[model samples]
Target: MWEKTMPINEVRELRGKTNIFLGVGAIEKIFDIAKEIKEKGIDKVAIVTGKSSYVKCGAWHYIEKALKENHIEFVLYNKVTPNPLSTQVDGATKMARELGAKAVIGIGGGSPIDTAKSVAIMTLYPEYTTADLYEYNFIPTKSLPVIAINTTHGTGTEADRFAVVSVLEDGKEYKPAIAYDFSYPMYSIDDPKLMVSLPKSQTAYTSIDAINHVVEACTTAVTTPYAVMLAKETVRLMAKYLPNALENGEDLEARYYLTYASTIAGICFDNGMLHLTHALEHPLSAIKPDLAHGLGLAMLLPAVVRNIYSARPEVLADVLSPIVPELKGTKEEAEKAANGVREWLEKVGVKETLTDLGFKEEHIEKLVELVFTTPSLDLLLGCSPIPPTKELVEKVYRESL
Candidate 1:
């Protein structure tokens, strides 16, 4: 008898050291943010973003106007790409430091935001490379301020304390995620209006990423009731609104709910942490740097669900039933639940399997090896319901293919 609550129509300012401005017209808050940082004596900031989303999504205009009005100086680093690289982070850090930039503003999705976090930390220790930080070669305790301007409804890097970057070592790329207390942004903006311009493919991919976040968060070993509650709402919102947003790209109402779903999903993983899906997806994107993070996660999710269901059947069944109504909270329904998830992904236009995305049986072994060898990924596997064995890793990758 529980009915879903309607999305709020008005903009609201959420307060914290990491203040968030969300909803329609929330990007305008950049004016206030710019002024606040300027008053703190930070006159120069480095803007780290991809080549175009910041401008294409209509956030760059407001951000640029705000900085100009506040007389704040900013240097642009627009070379960040999907599956962001440590070399790019290092390049940006070098630019920011040389320009005397005191803070970093990350625009677009997780890639740029994560790059900004890495840049913020690396700016302080000019001696350390991003690989050093991601590999735990040094424990960093401080970073320049980071402001996240989220233009996509996925990769809640805006609200979490984690950043993922790929580093090249021994002629192979190793993508590792780093978490530090200072990785949290000092300010974030999540304006649904900015998301209205997202393309159909990205819309589908990003929402799938949000769903995967909640799915793994709810089933991780550290999951709590609070995380479970947020996870269920995230799934429900994505189920109801993602289709509407896909059908009509300009539907602000749908964008609002999906954006909220992505944000809370970020919080869920921030609190509950993540497991196999994220652990596995990182290696996929790391190996194929062109693969979209959300798409990779989508490809891996069904098999991961089947593998983890027995560990927390009742919880997973409840959280996932919004998308998979056939889930009956019984151990016997694991396969059914996972199949239902795959069906839902297909419904959302994410029909590519691992092999369809160019992975082969020969690649499975390397994928499994990366799962164990990638820094911090093994730690994520430790939080899984089952043992983190090479056999199990190969089985999941093979099944996904």
Candidate 2:
């Protein structure tokens, strides 16, 4: 383990019959949820999803299939999009109200889970929009119990209180959402067996997204030693195992560690928040949609770190340097630490320049404008030692190209 400060992780500390149920494999993982549902004594179940991945991949269908087998009554609401629209969540909440769905199950990756968390909030509160909680909304109303079955483990949606959704508000894209301590899933299933068949591209994307989680958390200005320690372990696991999982889909150990790493990063960031890479990536995702969160981080981090190093170089380098031994020497040699991260990314196999990704040279100015104006920029911009100036951001993009 890389030594650092211990974590001051936030606590909700629910008591009683193990509020969370965890399963690593076995088809029974989905089957056992009905008992939990029965124990929660819920009426109808509203499943919020629609990416075609769950039904086809056996994750989404497992609950329904098991529900029928066990003679449990339920409903399915599958109208979710990639980023998830607030209107769609409202529609799902309406359906749940009509059906009287007493509980919710989120099956699939981050999007469906976000849909489920947001729907729970809307159904319970009935007053707030899915757009309201983008920045720690901390909605007070308690939500219907959620059982999140993560067929994939990139986002740590099960472990988090945040539900992220994007919508076009007033003809312009306004990414909005909320989070609260009460919003976390009552149960988060982490089963690596279900991950056996995950495709290479998705494995890469999700695992890289996990890497972004750890790296961004550790770099923040207000990070605690507790945050740094957990983030350090997470990055070490992601750096070693994410690539293995991406390269060899059936690598159970790799998948397990990466998945665990993903969850750990969410816990780490919840206490300390995140830094500029996430701040930069959000605008790109809103505008491009083509670039998902992880790939966007992959493209921007090398440049982001290189720039930040000139300012807060030592702390940042120490945080990451343990994982990348290539740069380890004396503190005086820490100047080369940023290079280690770039080399490690290449070794993990991030290819293509930003230009190769179809990021238009013409769009850089527009993206810069979006970055400056967005609320997320405010959330994350100050985390950087040298807060990004318009000219500096543009220069980073140019260097990236």
Superposing all C-alpha atoms, what RMSD in Å does each candidate have to the true structure?
Answer: 1.6, 5.1
- lDDT for each residue of candidate 1 in 94-156, tens digit (9 for 90 to 100): 999998999999999999999999999999998888889988899999999999999999988
What tens digits encode model 2's per-residue C-alpha lDDT throughout 51-100?
Answer: 57667656655677777766667777877766676778888888887877
Give every collision pair in model 1: none
Ten contiguous residues with the weakest lDDT in model 1: 1-10
- lDDT at residue 360 of model 1 (Cα atoms): 98
Residue-level error in angstroms, candidate 1, position 54: 1.0
Q: After superposition, how far is residue 351 of candidate 2 from its true place, in Å?
A: 1.5
Error of 1 at 350 (Å): 0.9
> Which stretches in model 1 have alpha-carbon errors above 4 Å?
1-9
